[model samples]
Target: MSGRLSATVVQQCVVSLGDVRTRIDVSIKRRFLADQDRVYPGLECPVPNDDTVELLSSVIDLYGLTREVLLLEIPSYPRLEGATVPDSGGSNSGQDQDQTDGHPFAVLSEFRERMAK
Candidate 1:
C-alpha cells in the first residue's frame, strides 16, 4: 500500500504548556507478504531490514497503521511558535530552590558535612 497522510493536530508545548498546532504530511509506502515464515524459513520471527516491508494478515489495520504513523511523525516535544520559557538562574524561588537542592554537588556537600560531623 502507498498513500499520503495529511493531518493537523494540537499538542501542548513542552516548555510553556500552551497549545501548539502542527501540520503533518507524510508519504507512506509498504509491502506486505502473505507468509512471513516462507520469506525467512529458519528464523523464528524475521524482522524486515527495509522499513517498507512487513508480514500480511487476514485483516489490514489501516486505522492502526495511520495512528502509528501519525504518532511517529508528531513532534515528541512540541514547542509553540515564539513561546519561550524563562530560565531560573539559581534564584531563591521555591521551585528553583527545590531543583537546585537535587544537584549532584549539593548531595556530595551534604554527604561531606555528615561525614565531618
Candidate 2:
C-alpha cells in the first residue's frame, strides 16, 4: 500500500529559543505476506524487505504506524531563522557558575576515568 502524510508544526530553536515553522511529509509503503505454516531450508537468511510486513491480524494499526513515522521525521534539534549559535556553548554555557559539580553522574564519570587510566 501507498499513502501520504502532511502536517505543519511549530518548532522551537534550541539555540535562540525562537519559533520555527516546519513542514512534515511522509510517504508510506507496506507489503503483507501470506501465512507461513512452515519454514524450509533457505539459501542464506531470508531477510524481509524494509517495506514488507506480516499480516497476522485482520486489523492494521494505522495510528501506531503513523505516530512512529512522525516521531522519526520530527527534528530532535531545531535552529531558528538568522540566529547565530555559538559552537562552544552547551545547555548551561551562558551561566556564570561551574556546572560540573552539580552533574548527577559526576562521581560515576570520575570512577570511569580512573578505571580507564
Candidate 3:
C-alpha cells in the first residue's frame, strides 16, 4: 500500500520557546509479505535495506502507520528562521537580554550573582 501524507503542526522553538509552525509532506509505501520463510525452505531471506517491507499480520493497522509516519516527519527540534539560541555562559552584550529573559535557566544565573555578593 502507498499513499501521500500532508500535515501542518505547531511546535515549540528549541531556542526561543516560541511557536513554530511546520508543514510536512511525505510519500509512504509499505509492502507486506506473509510466510516468506515457508516459501524458502533452507536459505535465509535477505533483509531489505529500506523500511518499506513488513511481515504480514492478521490485521494491518493503517491508523498506526499514519501516526508513525507523521511523527517521523515532524521536526524533533523546531526552530524559527533567523532565531538564535542564547549562549549558555551568558553574554555581556545587552542584545541578548530580551532573549534570555524567557530562558528557564535565566533565574539561576541571577540567584548565583546575588549569592556571590
Candidate 4:
C-alpha cells in the first residue's frame, strides 16, 4: 500500500522574530510478509563469516524521521516583533530602596539590634 500524509506546522522564526508557517508532506509505502526469509527483496540475513552482512527487517518506521525533522527545523531563539523589555538599573541602583511593602523582614535594622547578643 502507498499513501500520503500532510500537515501544517506553525513555528517561530528566530531570525525574523516572527511566526513561520509551513506545510510538510510525506509519502509512505508499505508491504506485507509472504514468507519467512523472503519478506523483503533487498533484505539480507546476518552471517557470522560474512564481513558485510546486513540485517533487514520488514517494518519501516517513518514517524521517527518525521519527529527528527520537525525538531531540527525548529528555531533556536524566537522573539516577538515589537516586544518591550523594562529597564533594570545597574547593580546598586535599587539597593537602597525598600522592595517589600510592610513585611516583617522589611525592618532589617530592628532585626540586627535584637540579634546583637
Candidate 5:
C-alpha cells in the first residue's frame, strides 16, 4: 500500500533556542513481499531508495511513520533570516558589531598555533 503524509511541527533553533516552524510533506510507497530476500521489478520503498527501512510483516505503523518523517524533515539548525548567532565571547553587540571581518574562532586558531609551536 502507498499514500501521502503531511505534518506541521515547531522545532527549537540550534543557536537562538527559539521556535522554528517546519512543514513535512512526503509521498510514501511501499511494496511488501512475501518473506523475500530482495524486492523485484524496479522496487520502490516508502522512504528514499538510499535510505530505506524494511517494514516487518504485513502491517505498517502510520503514527510512527508520520513521526519519523517529521523528525527527518525538521532542520538541525533553523535560523531566522538576518538573525546572527552570537560569538563565543558572549559579547552582545546588539547587531551593531561588524562580525563579517574578524576571525570568529581566533582563540581556537591561536591555541592550534601554540600547540604546533
Candidate 6:
C-alpha cells in the first residue's frame, strides 16, 4: 500500500520578519513481514507507546510513523541570523559573548578560583 499526506503549518521564519507558512508532504509504503525481530537497514523500527513489548501484533504503518517523524523533526525554536529578543525592561541584556574562536573552558577560570579556597 502506498499513500501520501500533505499539510500546511505556520512556522517561525528562519530568515524573515514574520511567521512563514510551510507545506509538508509525506509518502508511505507498506511492507509485509512475518518476523518482527528481523532488522531492516535504512528503516526505522516502530516506536512503542509504553513499556509493553508488543510483538508482530502490530503492523508497520508508515503514515502514522511519518506524522510522528515530522513532529520530531520540527525545530522548537527558529530564529534568523542576528535575531535578538526584545528586552522586557531588564537591567542586563541576555546577549551571549562572541566565543566562536575562543575556548569554551574560558568560563571555568572563575570556578577554579572559587575551588582554590
lDDT of each: 0.82, 0.71, 0.86, 0.55, 0.64, 0.57
lDDT of 1 by residue, 1-117 (tens): 999999999989998999999999999888987685676677787565998887798899999888889999999999988887786654345664675565747656656888999
In order of lDDT, best first, we have 3, 1, 2, 5, 6, 4
| Residue pairs that clash (backbone atoms under 3 angstroms), model 4 | none
Q: On lDDT, who's better, 2 or 6? A: 2
User: What's the CA error at residue 46 for candidate 1, in Å?
Assistant: 6.2
Q: Model 4, 77-104: lDDT tens per residue?
A: 5455565554457332354344544464
Ranking by TM-score: 1, 3, 2, 5, 6, 4
Score candidate 2 by lDDT. 0.71
User: lDDT by residue for model 3 over 10-54, one digit each (tens)?
Assistant: 999998889999989899999988766776777687767769988
lDDT of 1 at 51: 84
Which stretches of candidate 2 lie above 4 Å from their native place?
34-45, 49-55, 86-117
Among the numbered candidates, top lDDT falls to: 3
- RMSD of each candidate? 5.4, 8.4, 6.4, 11.4, 7.2, 9.5
Which model is ahead, 3 or 5, in terms of lDDT? 3
List residue ranges in candidate 4 displaced over 4 A.
Answer: 1-56, 92-117
CA error at residue 24 for candidate 3, angstroms:
0.7
Candidate 2 lDDT tens digits, 1-117: 668889877888998888888899989776765445433344354547664475555687889777877888888988877888665664445452265647866557667888999
TM-score of each: 0.70, 0.58, 0.68, 0.32, 0.54, 0.41
Clashes counted in candidate 1 amount to 0
Which candidate number would show the highest TM-score if scored against the true structure?
1
Model 6, 22-94: lDDT tens digits are 6678764444444434656556666555422323535565556667757854666666556676655532224
Error of 4 at 90 (Å): 3.7
Q: Candidate 5's residue-wise lDDT over 43-112, tens digit each?
A: 5533435444454676777777767766777777887556676666543254524653476675465569
Show the lowest summed lDDT stretch of 10 residues, model 1.
87-96
Q: After superposition, how far is residue 57 of candidate 6 from its true place, in Å?
A: 2.9
